[model samples]
Target: MADRDKDSSAESRRILDRIAREADSSGSSLVSRTVKRARDHVSAADVDEKDWVDHLGTRIGRVLGLVICVGLLAWLVMFLVRGA
Candidate 1:
């Protein structure tokens, strides 16, 4: 029906206009733009590389700290045994 078609067309245009206004507004639009830029400009390889480097760095630091703590405990035990 012609009347039904006109009604649906008008509704769709209203929905599109509302979405356009939201995307233009300041606060939520900034987040939307940032996400769009990250999708467009940032590379998957760079993210992967940074993630790998961070993961390895955290693992290495934890291992080093544990080793140092164990060494200190061993030295303390030896000192106490020798003194006794």
Candidate 2:
């Protein structure tokens, strides 16, 4: 049992060290990746062959969806606060 525990601990340490080294080499932080994703989503870069009108509509739709979600969240918070 003691030998097994030692082997497992050493293996776990090695795996964690490799992960840390890879993360350091990649050099892309969480905030930067999040920002890049948001930019791509808002700009609709994933949509292919879209004209200006289509792009504008997509942006508008995204904004409207966001607004609706915020409104709903606010209403929920207010309802909870009021105990209604």
Candidate 3:
């Protein structure tokens, strides 16, 4: 049991070491650090507010048009079925 525990611990340590080295080599750690710094330094006012309004308006118009078209098609179909 003791030998098994020792081997498991050593294997865990080696796996962790490999992961750490791979992260460092791939520059993921640097990217994460840079993202943290950017988030910390970012101000709400730095973002564009107009883009939000424009995006919302565009989405609303698309949804409204879809609803209108669907309602009109349903009405037309119902009217034709009743006539037949």
Candidate 4:
């Protein structure tokens, strides 16, 4: 590949590596256990890695939709208030 493409690939790999390490180090791993009220032991189940990514994507989409809706509402409200 070209030099710039190689550099971009390297950077992307580094970012992916960092994400993987963070996922490993995060306390939210599947094996973690916690006690609930009345001495109930709750264990985290093994969540599929792709499921996590899908969930993140869903959240991002929802946030983007919300922002767009809010912006449109604001513009409409301003226009009406100013009689534009």
Using TM-score as the measure, the top candidate is 2
Off by over 4 Å in 2: 1-26, 48-50
Q: Global CA lDDT of candidate 4, please?
A: 0.65
Kindly indicate the candidate among 2 and 4 with the higher lDDT. 2
| TM-score ranking from best candidate downward | 2, 3, 1, 4
Q: For all the candidates, what are their Cα RMSDs to the real structure?
A: 18.0, 6.4, 15.9, 17.5
In Å, residue 53's CA in model 2 sits off its true spot by 1.2
lDDT of 2 by residue, 18-62 (tens): 989768846888788889998788777766654888878887888
Maximum-lDDT candidate? 2
Model 3, 1-84: lDDT tens per residue? 999999999999999999888777656577788877655434233435679876566556666776798999999999999998
Clashing pairs in 4: none
Residue-level lDDT for 14 in candidate 4? 100
For candidate 4, the per-residue lDDT at 10 reads 96
Kindly report which residue stretches of model 4 are placed more than 4 angstroms away from their true locations once superposed.
1-50
